[model samples]
Each structure stands twice: as C-alpha cells, then as structure tokens.
Target chain A: MDADVEAARPWVAEASPTFITLIDQNHLLSSLYNMVNVPQAVWIDEQGRVVRPTETGGSIDILREFDPEAGAFKPEAMARAGAAKALYMEAVEDWARNGADSRFAYDPDAARQRVSRQTPETMLAHAKFQLGRHLASLGRVVEAEALFTECRELHPDSWNIFRETTEKMDTGIAAGEAFWGKVMGLGEKQYYASIDMDGMP
Target chain B: MTIVLTETSNSECVAAPSTTDLWLDADAVTAATGWTLKPEGFCKDDICVPTPADAENYVADGKVNVASFWRLMDRPAAASKDGDVWFLGEGATERNDALLSLEAPDFTLPDFSGKLHSLTDFRRQRVLLITWASW
Candidate 1:
C-alpha cells in the first residue's frame, strides 16, 4: 500500500487505533484491487466478495487549506486527490457497517459491468505499457520507446505509466526529458482540466 | 497467449512470443526456478508465481523445446567452454505472454530495505497503494 497522502498525514498522526502503511513497490495490490486511479478503493469481504467497487474516497475539504497557484505544487491536483479520497472514504464507511447487506455492495451483475467499464482505451494503454516493458527488457529500446509513447498518448492522465516509461528509457537515451516531460505536463494539464470539467470549487 | 514448456533430463524451460517461437510456460519456468506452475499458480512451498495459464498447444507443438525455440527467437543456448555450462540470453528482457486472465498474481515483493510483503498483509486493514514517481 504505497501511497502519497501528505494531506492525510496530519490526521493519521493524530489518530487513535494503530495503523500501519505498507509500501507497495510494484503496485501488486493496486493491480489486484483494480485501482486504476489515485484515491480509488475496493472493499473485499471475508468471503472475497468486493463489497465496494473502486470509488473515490476520503475528504476533499482539506484542499481548502492549500494554495494551488503556488509555485511547483499544483493546487488542482491536490483538490482532485481530495475529491477522490472523499468518495473512497464514504464507500469504506458504507461497507464497514453494512457488510454484504450494504447498499454500496454491488450484485454480481453490477460488479461485472463495473469491471467492463474500464474502457477499451484504458485497456489498450495497459497492453501498450506491458508491451513496452517487454521490449525494453529485450534490449529493444527504440521499439519500447515507441510503445511507451503510444501508451502516454492514450493514457495521458496515468502518472504511473509515464513514470515507468521514463525510467525504462533511462538517462542516456536521447530526447529523454523532452519526450517524458511532455507527458508529465499533459498529466498536470489534465488534472486542471478535470477540475474545471467537474465544476469543482 | 500460449505458455510453452519444454523439458530435458537435467532441466526444463519456458519460452514465449509464440509457443512455436519459444517455451514460455510453467513447466519451463519450473525448470528454470525449480518450482512448478499449478492451477493455484507458480509454487515453491508457500510462495507461488500466480501467473498460471494453459500451455497445451505450446507443449504439443514443441514451441517450448529449449533448443528449438531458442533458435527461433535467435536466443543463445547453454554453451560449455571450460566445463561450466554458460546459459546466454538477454537479461531483464520483457516478453508478451498475452492476457491470459485479469486475475492478479499474488506474490511478496522485496522492498528497498529487503523486506518481503504481499497484498494479504493489508487484509482487514486500510491501505492506499499509491503508484507515483518523483519525475
């Protein structure tokens, strides 16, 4: 459970029950839980049924404390993270008390539908990322670069995809910053775009 | 996505790309790692690979045969020069095995501090696995 929740650190520091944070080095848990985006969560019951699908959780009101316009740090990203956290936290609470009977729990059909909603574009990006990883491992840097570029173009909002692509490209590879930075900038721009589109305050 | 497994008396190996091109399945992996791929996934005692898929066609077609598939992929085979068998192949190479299933393979990964952990460790606990980068 590797997470960057500086906003929640204060709350966690002030909490009562003991809580431990696990750093997921390879995103094994994130992939297992189908957490495609930041602040997404899935609540699985003892029987292994997902009581709550991945949804935005936690409180976004905390963003009110930060200034987005400040240099280096984008406030809109903070706000988006907050909204996602709020939704996820709300779902968690619903599942915690109600168990299987919780209104938040999806029927098998709904769960399947939710899984299917991942969208072909998203799935293709995953494939492209995987293929890039494969090619990179094979020492075919050029081919891997192309695949990763396509992946970024398709999934511009995924920080993980962009980061992994850049890391695989390494520093010695030419056009490293220009190619990778373009995607990083796009992600930031999308973050701001999302806030405006959602009409978030 | 076919998983091809080829076996020899002393060893077995898995190859991929196309099972016809290489043996990339559980049996071959077991030969390489001394573990077996089962329905429950790759297992060596309690630890498992968890990326199990059918490799019948690959095996039957001899795509997993070490020597045959190596030649097909232009990968080198074990060469003995000084009485020590040196297996040669590009390390850190990624292979496309295809989307066998959406199920995530369960395994404990070693962190920077050399600690092994798994998703089950966070069961019944609140966890946030944030995948991000400094860049």
Candidate 2:
C-alpha cells in the first residue's frame, strides 16, 4: 500500500486495466497481512479466503546487478525482469481459470502455514509509522523523522514502513543507497521469498 | 494528552493507559480502544473479558486510563514515551485465528475516483489481489 495515491495514479492510468484500483495511504494491508514489501500478491478465493499468501508478483531482485554508476541495467537483468511478469501472471491465470482446484492454489493448511503473524513490535511499528506520516503531513518533519526511526528500528524487516520517506513510494521502485544496501545485504536470501510455483525463473 | 492511532485516522485521546498494565473501563476507553466497559466486563462483539478487580481507575478528571486495556485483554499495545499515542493491535490469538481459518483479512480502500471497495465485493469470484506501489 502507498501513502502517495496521487503519485501512483499515473501508473494506474498507464496500465489501463479493467480491474479496480484502490489506494491505501495508511499501509493497512501490510499491517493486516504482514506484508513486508511491495509488488506482492495475495490470492483470495471467492469466499474472501486467502488461498495463497504473499508472492513476489514476478519481481525478482533485478536491480542488484545494475551499475548505478553507469545508469544502465545489465541486458541479462532486463530480460529476466521482462519475463518476471509472465511467471506470476501464469500462476494467476491458472487460479482464475481453475479456482480452488488450480494446481497453484494452496490447500487450507498449506495456506495457513504461510501467513505470518503480526508481532507486538510490528504492531507498534505500524502505529509509529502511521503517526510519523501524520506528523509529516502536519509539517512536523523532525518529529516525524524520530518516529520513523523508531518504527524502522522496531520492524527492520518492513521495507514498506522503512521506505515511506524515500522516493515516490507509490511507484514500488525504491532507489538510492538505503534500498540498494538492503538488497545487496540480502546475499543468500531471495529478495521476495521465491514463489513456490515451479518454473520460477 | 493521549493520541490514538487507528488504521484510518488519528485523534487526540482524553485518557492515557497507566504503566501498571491494568486496563480500566471508561467512556474514553472505548472511544480510543473500542472495548466497551459493561457490568459483565469489557466486551467487543461476543467476546468479553472480565475487568480486573484492582482496576478501579476508570476515569480521572476528564482522562480515562485506556491504553493498557488491550494488553489486559491479551493483546499488545505501544505508546509514546509520555504514554500518549496508544497503538492498539489485535492479539496473536485473534490474528492467528484468522490465519488458521485462511480468511483473507477484509479491507475497504478507495479507488482513484474515490469510490470505496471492499475485498468482499468480489466474493464468490476468484480474485488476484495485487499490491503495488506507485513509487
């Protein structure tokens, strides 16, 4: 979810999709779902049940190879990034067409296992982040910074809360040292837990 | 001066929860934390928790000791250093139950045009809810 709905609007318009697009400036979904990053997808069945928990929505950590000094993406990374969408979309289509019976759909137990719980610290982080945004909106920049710092400390895994004051968050693309540093630091870990589906590139 | 931060809004609260961790029942308590103080105890929907006998301070002057109520109910909460800005969160039991049930947490958000839509609006239909940032 994004605080800057207006900044994200142009992208929604560009997509020109038939699906409904909603805005969440408060990052309520992240708080509710325990989502740590953006560009994640949740598969919900007809009865408002989560059939599949968060997935990377086809975004791999492609920018890791990007030489920012050169201001260009390696061709290999670009190609892989281009194909990322189809990998996730194929899974979506399978579920859409097959519903609960889809091979991609998770069983109740499997699905439940994947859902992460909101810890006390995380819940507090949500409050601090929300308050930080509120304070920032009120022109209390220094106070907002203090709150943001505390919240980020409390929930270091939450890139959503950590990236609030960064580049237009609505874009889902984070730039600069802070974002890249985290990415690079994730040496052995998958940027987004690899979607369990087979044929994941 | 307590400030309650909910998912949707932030407002000043008349009550700040005391540090002893005993949550009381008072008018401002429910206003900020949503648990109503009843003769039976603090109740939300069908769930009611018996108020501690020692929790006598419901309201002091215009302030209600409302912050620690969530902790008393087995939930967790956080506050600013001065005890202002209570952030109440769903307890692990409640949150874990939803996960155990596999129920997608329902949310209502507004479209670009300002029309509100809930996740349940697509009930009975397979929906791929994708969260993206405009950043």
Isolated chain B TM-score per model:
0.32, 0.74
- lDDT of each residue in A50-90, candidate 1, tens digit only: 44444433423332233436633366656566666565555
DockQ for every model comes to 0.09, 0.61
Q: What is the lDDT of residue A147 in candidate 1?
A: 66
Q: For model 1, what TM-score does chain A reach?
A: 0.50
C-alpha TM-score for every candidate: 0.47, 0.86
| Full-model lDDT, candidate 2 | 0.72
Which docking category, incorrect, acceptable, medium or high, applies to candidate 1?
Answer: incorrect
Q: Write the per-residue lDDT of candidate 2 for residues A13-49, one digit (tens) a residue.
A: 9998898888888888777777888778888888888
lDDT of 1 at A95: 61
